[model samples]
Target: MTVSNTRQQVKLSDAVQRIQPSGIRRFFDLASTMDNVISLGVGEPDFATPWNVREASIASLERGITSYTANAGLMELRSEISSYLKTNFGTSYSPENEVLVTVGASEGIDLALRATVNPGDEILIVEPCFVSYAPLVSLVGGVPIPVPTSIKNDFKVLSEEIEKRITNKTKGIMLSYPSNPTGAIMVKQELEEISKVIIEHDLLVISDEIYGELSYDSVHVSIPSIEGMWERTILISGFSKSYAMTGWRLGYVAGPEIYTKAMLKIHQYAMMCASTMAQYAAIEALKNGKEEMENMKVSYRQRRNYFVKALKDIGLNCHMPGGAFYAFPSITITGLTSEEFAEKLLLEEHVAVVPGNVFGSGGEGHIRCSYATSLPHLEEAIKRMDRFIKRTNG
Candidate 1:
């Protein structure tokens, strides 16, 4: 090694340069450094993983089942997932050929994009969408075309809007319902209409149904279940939200065999398999965790109602979220941008919420408040937020 005046420069892929740090993570990073911060920033569920699920993982360990699984995952787990899908959503999938187990829905998103998109292809993303989709699309050399939805309609994307955004370059659409930032979900009829547009355009759909089990008022619809849509739709879901198993990092994607096989190839090369123990635990969750999932849904529904009411009472414009655990309340009444409102609230009241603009352009006037925390924390956060708002307005 010679010491020289000129140093070799490190290089990164253009794809890496095109992406930015997640906006949601920035708020958490700042909140972590402060004391007594009540964060509704991260979307993680606050509940502990259910006892039975934990026990299953422990049992797996006790049974010496700690080896790697097949790249597509264990056959029995896949079969359970396939059965669960049929039982819960009335969708049919062949576990042996159409499902690929992934590290998380995050990995499923990346793997699907990696397998399907080529340079300059466009992926349609609805605004106020999950933070990960755009970056992942860019990473896979696909252009992210965001279609902004409105708060007036509760952030629901219309079929016409989707049709308007399609172009010759459009390759697919990314759908996230019981959406991360907005908590908006598409009912069965709504999804059927959207599916028609997708079918007409001959486009692929990557449906992120990670929060499918958390709906409050109605059933969560899967676009793939619609006649003629299953072959073109890739459904991404996981145990993270529904089972409160974020740390377990278990998820899956089910679709036509042609696409899933391609996705599995990428999964096989990039990460051999999801954690073996987690997969085994997930098998138990799929097989025996229905009551536990329902219990969590009940608690989440109560918290969602409480927080939405509190926010509205405090003069923020809020819609009662139909699914997931977030309330996307407009911060405009406070006379601040979503980011400014969030920053001031954190500094003045030690309450943390993510600015809606982090999701996309349509979220500019809103902020996302998660009710995934305990009731006590939610109450305290509301009190602090009330004081901060009154003081600022006064």
Candidate 2:
């Protein structure tokens, strides 16, 4: 039979069609196309990976240890990861069954959502949060219910807010502390309050503590370490943030074997395992990179202090970020939406930032600026931003 005159287009999956492109990437890509643009957009550390960690990976390669690791990852790295989490996060796991190394915390997210989310299941995402959480939940056929948090509470998700949103369809909640967009963090007491709600609701938790090491004033608390949460929380973290190992693409998921085993099955099919060389490097980072890691933390803390003050001094009010390297400042005084502010700043001043609304509710009228850069760069960016605001507001 002859084909019809009108050609049919390849059908796309409903999941793929429903998801929109990353709002962060749109500005990042646009900035990339330009020169002399100082980007406070991407949330990546500026520090180089510690020398020992890099040397370990190089040594591994020299020894011809380039084979694919077991689907669950190299057992040695898993044990080290287990130890690291226990010491730092106060949460323990069995390296044998409770840990699965993946490509990145990003991949860990995909695995966790796919493994747990059933069609129509509702995953409660705390908003003004990471952009990936809701979309990943949606891609797995789960409904992502946004629980909005505002600057009034320093962007912390209150227990009452969580309790009010719970329903029969609610399966679990996604939490990111030292949050990507807002740099908001919940203290142990705050998390405990929310933990009570999660326990009462008998819900699962996906705690993205990738930025745990970047906490400024207080220790980062893991949900699994809280009472009644060990059995329900899946802890996702990795070398990307703490060790400046983003390019290494190494991350691990630790939780009850029931959840991790499911993630492993998916990891086996989708990714097989994380890089062997990176796993070797991560082992070194955990064992001997603490001094360098702490040094980076000190530098970030300095940058954060300077950047927050600089933003406020320029009349863009910002909450002092408790952790991570981002500063989400309200640009409402300039009479511009978040998108307009970010676009104009990038085009007019050649300084790049991510618009807040891209991060979900409570993000409107704000912009996420990463201070994970040199102090001089951050200072200059702020000066340019101040100039732009003065000129715009006038």
Candidate 3:
């Protein structure tokens, strides 16, 4: 008498359900299926991880030193990170208590938001940015507010723009300069302007400086180095881009004790610790990888210069990116939407690029092409893209 047949759909968490899959990944997956496809889509260094770093990892393995380190990460690695930051960016932190190594900078972003964001809290994200930031914020029950920066400002967020968006609900601001997608970077003066608004509003900042060492035109400014910013900024960086250590999955978060401890608590429960061997590699990278890192940087700068110039020569308008390996160029000349341009270019020219609109507002009518590959690949991609653009517009 009791059993009527019925099936109810299983519900996923609202955070998971609401967020869209990464737009960058969609193109990457498509590119993987095609042969001879020159992909300017993914933001990864083409260089192999430095040999010495690898050797360090190998030495550790040979020695059977594979046990887990402290939950906060190996103390030696943290100390190296502290020295690296201080020497390179003029930002200081206590290696003992302030730095927490995570799986990657991506995880640092997650821990930062989870530790700070409360239900209904707002986080201002400077866009066009890395694909992960807003989604991670939403996952933590924070409202991700896109503070869009246009090509006019070289994609740098303005103080007035930030001030206009600030409300009591905005708990923090997320910034990635030498930005992904756009490659826009803020100079000290520009950051100082934004810092005034941040300080006045009493907002915390999560500064993702993953590409800090890649700045081409000027020195990279660590936001925490700005007056009054150290107390409120969580500085996130890693060995991935700078040291060609992406697969190693190591990155760190450094800030005041209150915030660092909060993220550390989350890290303890979630990640436990970053890889022990990777930590040894990172120490090697910091201690002796400078020359190799600079060599890679010079190659990136060459690729960037060639690629950006090639885009402009092909009649696409692109601002010279100050840092990072991306060139966000306007595709409106082809009279196609960003997605249309990317799809058609992939289908027609065997070239893959991520459409700009996926990066957030103000990213429409443009496309993001990564110059992280070799110079020859970049040149070949540009040739294919040139053909596509001319064919489309003709």
Candidate 4:
């Protein structure tokens, strides 16, 4: 067959092209390829998936269980997730109808947005959030309105901030507790206040509680566990962080039957099903993984304390992160933009960290460093950072 005069110029979706690529991955791409690099950029656990969890996946694979599960997911896994959530946060979900397994919380975010949003609708995203929130909203033709939280307030999403953004076109809000980039977790009282705004505004919520278990100061409280938020909240969580199961790619979205049914429609079409072995592994994780997760959390707590102190000692303004594995410190003192600071530090000290501005507007002047690596690496990274800061500021 003769080729055309020119190869077909494929038309890309304007919606897809409209948003930018993830800022986190840019650092990862550079740092991952280099030798002698200590990366605090990726927000993933350093721990391996617990032996029991990995064994389950191995067992399933050994049995040749590579086929797709139900579109909604394995009923058994969903049931375990429901029971786990109820036990942890007192929120009840019907395994069959209310819980749908996803590829990860990433997929849950996409599925929830696609199901509920329409063009021109506004979704409230708390700033310094994960990079995907805004882009995902844009992909679904929903407008993302970021609500900024300050370091002074310890970065909790206040009800007042949320209320200020609630216009008639606002359809929902996206929240991540034990927030990415900042590691700020909302207390129950704060969530209660935000819950009131959610109720008064009659808004829906997409709560990403991927780091809920890693809260160092207190237990994580689910927004839906509060009165008046259940029916309207879509809860997204997963095993990637909690179980060190990033490779497993298993997560679940829980909501009211109506919203879940809608999400399932999207999940069925876009994903068809999550990984069968991963779903099976997640069931084992939910049943037996708490102790292992707690052990990992203890190590993280130690790292947080040591790293936060080290940052302060190095003359950086860093807030004590309450949860998750990241410490977001202001780099304004060094007189570098977040991207510049990150790139320079990577070049000078071979230490890679995420630039905060990539997360959203309010993230300017800050850098996010994940303490999820081993204590030794964190210590060395801090040493390198101290040297870099001194040399740069000097």
Candidate 5:
């Protein structure tokens, strides 16, 4: 009687099950399974970690400094981070109370959402955004609202759009400049305008400046540093992009003390602290890696220019990205969905790009090409993409 041959399906938590898997990853998985593929799909630096930064981590290991670091990270490293922020962006944070190190900027994103979001609260997310933001908001029981930006406006999130979307349920906003898919940045005036809206709405902000050092035009402005904004903005940044330390998994959040305290509590119980060796390496990076960081930026800018030009030459309309390593080019001319374009481009030319809609709605007619690789690879990817475009158009 107990052995009725019935197989039952296991269920996932509805909260987790309802969120869609990242669209950015499918193409990445497809690209990896193919040979001789040039991947412009992932936003990662191709540069090796600077030799000195690597050496510092090695030195820490040789000295047997492998114990778990303080939950807030080493004081020395935090101090250096504080100094780097001030010197570079004119922003200040107290190492003792305002910064909490995490595994990566991704963790910081989670901790920030967890600290502030309540069920049914709405978090305004700008599109085209990083793929993680919307899901992260949903995971915290918050509604993720999209504020669509356009290529015609250089993809900057307009304050008017943000203002229009604000309702009594709105609790916060999330911004990433040197934005992921579009690589579009808001100049200080634009950010200042957006900050006005944030202030008027009395909204908290989670500002992702992970690509701060990669700005190609004007300097990257941290929203928290703007007048009246420090009280409301949570700043997220890390070593991955700036110092080519992606695998080391180090990032941090700096904000008002209360929010930092809340995030730190969640972080200690959930993650404890970031890697000890990585923290030591980051200390060295903030102290001496500026030149290396700039060199990488210079390289990326050249590739960005070359690739955007090449895409234009192929009859695809592309906006020159102001920062980060990605160029968002319109694929509407070929009359293909973003996924159709990316999948077919990979199969046809062995060149991989992320379909832009993965980022958000405004990205529907576009594809994201990362220029973080070498100039030669970018040139070749362009040639392959050009052929694919012609064949599709015909």
Candidate 6:
């Protein structure tokens, strides 16, 4: 064999090279390898997939329904999702034209960006946002423009702020509420203001409402439900957070026929379909698992309350999350950077949390602690955090 250095000469895409590994994953990797580490870092709900939903999956398998579904998804699952959205969120869509089941909301996000974004197009993402949005935008040759929200404003983006970011290159706004990390949610009034900007700017909206079913004080409001917004909005939601089906890997997107058709084309080529058994389970979740979801939300609410109170008592500046199972607390009082606080807490106290900067610049002074763990683990983690803070400060 000839001596060749060709392996080192391989060229990689700019998009791939620019992307960074997720900050959230670093702590998870450390926690996984450590003993007795209490992790508040994971974003998944701790509950098992409800028994009925699980049974549905098993039934599909026993019935030999193991083949791939249509690229868009099984008609039955799409129909169920359409009906669920209409009845639950007051958003109407035709299953045939509007829905495409994806591996998860993660895939739906990537598909939407891939289908819509041209090189150098801009995606408006709110901070602190989900970790995946920026990288996914980059993967499709789009630039992610983050609009920072503040804890003082309850992390809601002002309409004026959003309007200021608009430019000729802007293609869409990626909105995730009951947001990951921060758990900040916008009420109908806030969304209406955002809707006005989207309307005025003629911008497409990618609404990630995965936490729609988990709100504590109020119901979620989808921008697409507002008149004039539907045509330009793609609603991305799934059973993962709400139905405790994270491991099932099932989600879908609903939008106008034209946009959805394009997304479906990309999804067809990329994922083909979501998991077959998981799709059946999701149908049951949408159709008959409302009570189960409600119960899980109640548990999460209780945990949220407990965790917030504990953080406050430990001298952490915490805010009550309106939706989702996270508490994003400012740790600046401890005179520690977000990453420093997280690393010290993990190594010294065996408690794990994701640094706020992992989400974006707006998350700089904070850390995200998920209350998705059991009550006992949450209590123990809080105690460990308190001890660590005292020892460090002293």
How far is 257's C-alpha from truth in model 6 (Å)? 0.6
**Alpha carbon lDDT of each predicted model:** 0.91, 0.93, 0.92, 0.92, 0.91, 0.90
User: Please, what are the lDDT tens digits per residue for candidate 4 over residues 363-394?
Assistant: 99999999999889988998999999989999
**lDDT winner among the candidates?**
2
Query: Any residue pairs clashing in model 6, and if so which?
Result: none
The local lDDT score (0 to 100) that residue 336 gets in candidate 1 is 90
Per-prediction tally of clashes: 0, 0, 0, 0, 0, 0
Better of 2 and 6 by lDDT: 2
User: How high a TM-score does candidate 4 get?
Assistant: 0.98
Off by over 4 Å in 4: 1-7
Question: What is the lDDT, from 0 to 100, of the residue 20 in candidate 1?
Answer: 90
- Which residue pairs collide in model 3, if any? none
lDDT per residue (tens digit) for residues 79-179 in model 1: 99999999888889999999889999999999999999999999999889888999999987899999888888888899999999999999999989988
**Candidate 3 local lDDT, 299-378, one digit each (tens):** 99988888898999999999999998899999988999999999999988999999998999779999999899988888
lDDT of 6 by residue, 114-139 (tens): 88999999999998999999999988
lDDT for model 4, please.
0.92
Worst 10 residues of 1 by lDDT: 220-229
